[model samples]
Target: MSAELTRLAERVADLERRLSATTRTARLAYSSIEDGAIEVYDNDGTLRGSIGVQPDGTVGMVAVNAPPPPAPAPALVDSALAGLDVSWDGQWANDEDTTPLDLALVQVHMTALADEELSEETMVAALVPGGGRTGVATGTYEPMWIILVAVNTSGVAGPPSAPVQGQARRAASDDILNGAITDLQLAEAAVTEAALAAAAVGKTAIQDGAISTPHMVANSIQGDRIAVGTLDGDRITARSITGSQVIAQSLTANELAANSVTALQLAAGIVDATHIKAGSLTAGLLAADAINGKVITGSRLQTAATGRRVVVDPERAEVSIYSGIAEEMQPGGLHADVLDLGASKQAGVSLSAPSLGKGTAYLAMQSPNTTGGAGSIRLEPSDRITEPGYTYLLARQGNSTTQELIESYASAPSGGKITVQQQTSAGFTWRTGTTSATLRDGVLSVPNIAVGTARVTPVADKPTSFRVAKRLEGKEVRAFVTASTTVPGTVVEVAATDADNTGFTLWVTRTNATATNVWWLMIGSDA
Candidate 1:
């Protein structure tokens, strides 16, 4: 058996060598070879079916198939806009021609970033380290490929645009676009393209100036427009503002006295001092006509007991300068940040609203009721504020603008009026839990909290935990802008709502010692 196996192996080797040496290239139309074997050896080579005899022996060759045609190169898509600068005025409409349907444009202004800095390709590639079991198993992607996701909401509501990169955006309320490069091949193309485009013309513009002069505008037009080289020098005029006119936007000075150009305007002649000479010079507004109305000769002003202003004779002892308002409600001219609601033009008297009467507040008292002046009053937005004479005053305790509604209930243990106390930072101290400490002005009054905000819900029935009043604060930190600003302990608020007269509900967030979400508590009004 071993001898036969040796002979077979020798024969196979010989056959393979002959085939390797033999190469046939035959073409004569009619004669074609199929499933044939060739064997070559020394001049004593064995021939089976066909044989060729020649004087110098037959030179062997094999027919070689032509190489498959090469595939066409990928076409490059040329983009239209490379560099752009666009400006618009107050009034602008959609330009159907230039607006993109699915293409996303990322813009970086000169004030924000540069052009080359806008491209984010090489950076992203460097981040993706590639290698595998083999040396370069996960070969680097081609540099030219760019990836993108595009979606459209044009048919649904808003304009449809493809996102160049990942960015959250909102266009029209209903429009949305969703597109993505789902394949690696596509991503390579898209992302690279985007990087090139952004690098071409990267940054946007920075606004140079808000208001330029007439000299800056060359074209001549009527309203506020000036020809270049035409406008010169600044126009300065003296003006006075009074009454509840917002001082921030109005009066340059609180009160105009000597050298006070309050009463002078466009007449422009370098005149100084507007002397108070007559009835009710209550810091009145000086319009074009008012500046022309009064003419004064001297600087000194005098006042009589009848509240009338007269030219100072310098001999009279009544030229008193009665400064600003002096409050009667509180000393030091301060009263719990009182809101002005009066029409009296009396200087040295901080006015309070006794219900200002309409035009009467402006001129002499006309109507017996109603008034118009700047005043502070809390506002609560509602759709069910239906009571004929009731208007809710909104109060907030924390940084959030939302004022939640809380209802409270209490019952006498022995048939006495129910009273509740407010807890402060130092815990329950004197009068801290007493009703009188909170009561004010003969009513069930609220305490003057640093963050003074609350809504009183008159009780019908006491809650199950009657003694359990809340100490309010936040689980997570939230600020309260009181008169100015205060710390965590400064905030406190109460709110309540009633649908049926029978009962009400209360909602509040009770905080614990630690400022974390763990202590956030919600309680409702039982009464």
Candidate 2:
């Protein structure tokens, strides 16, 4: 029984050894299903072995001994660049720190590699599981990297990694020079004037008929490119050029085709008096209502010269004075200047015609005549009589320089006693017998008077006693009476008094005398 138990114990011990070995292998093969990674750990839970498909889709494995004691922070040795992302590997792992460092120093240096020279350095967070397979940093385009360094939790610094060199992709112009592109390869119309070098694509460079309208870009041709007179009438389509397309004031009369410029072709209000040739427009050339008020400034037709007749209507024609019709006619013809009085007469003296007729006319001045009717100045013919030595009835002085005699009148100074009409070389002249009077403003003034005694002859027969009466329209009148002869024992008196606005009464008395002779005088106005 003892021997059988010993054998049993030995077999049990052997199985136990086998189980221990299998357990060791199983621990090495233990994997994370998500990442297909096999990991081996020591009894102290430290990483010892790892086998996995890496992030790059490549198989990799690592075997490590029990880690050495915490050493200085590891260093980066080499780096590779893919676009902006940088990858690096180095002796960065240490047993003293979990991962690279719970608080690690990961620094990246960025620099513009070409075209521009710029550099900046910054600290970045350490990537997970940082060490050999670490994502370093992302940098600007065309960037050239600097060495990467790290510090562990112990504040120990690592050596710098090798710099990663990079360059930007080639530009299109560079591509063309490298035989990567050809003329046929360019998109249609891709080449532009701005893109060409100075003096490039000259006439010699272009093949004949190679650059037609389809090949040329719109609005690319300049005025200097076109030769003078190259574009004839047939070359241009009608109305093809708009007003905006033509430079202002660029066209002259010679440049336009014959009969090509019409009203429709012209911009509104572009043609003014300055553009029109004198006498080019006439009444016969005008269409009915072709010219509107806005187009024609009526003032342009106004002639400043006076005395020009303007036919304003079918019924009448008027004399124009500085673009306006004359308002009145004086002895010197129509007046150019007029003053408005606002419903009142404003002239020093104004004369108006009675009515419109051949005989009807206005005179600025009239000369009074004692023998006949008044004579006046005429404006239609602008006529005046010139009597060099003879006295004229009326005279008008203008501007102290010129004087005109309106008329010559025949005057009979005394009361009318019809005499034989005779023509004398001195013309008609009369003298009053011992009496002279001056008339002004319908009033008569007698400076001196004389009385003569003659048989007291009465011009008209009267009953017993009669006094001569005179009519006066005024407030009052003064009379002066003188006896022709003063005889002894005889008295005479004369008095004058106001009557009803039309006349005055004169009383003549004589006592102890059968007859008396008297000369009477009166002064008053005729209203």
lDDT of each: 0.27, 0.44
Please give, for residues 1-527, the per-residue lDDT of candidate 1 as tens digits. 99999999999999988777664433454674332323232333222122232212453332111121211111122211221122111110233333233222211111111123222211221100111111111111111222211112211112211212111122343353454335653643365534665457333432556435532333333435557766444442224222322335555555546675553332444332453345634546545576575766545554543322232433332223323233222111111222232322211212122121211111111111122221222332221233232223322122111122221222233222222322333322122223233433333422321122222222223211111123332232222211111345422322333312222233232222221111112322322
Model 1 / residue 438 / CA error / Å? 22
Per-residue lDDT of candidate 2, residues 122-174 (tens digit)? 33334322443344433223445444555444345454444545433323453
Runs of candidate 2 exceeding 4 Å displacement: 1-177, 184-190, 194-199, 202-232, 240-527
How high is the lDDT of residue 129 in model 1? 10
Number of the top candidate by TM-score? 2
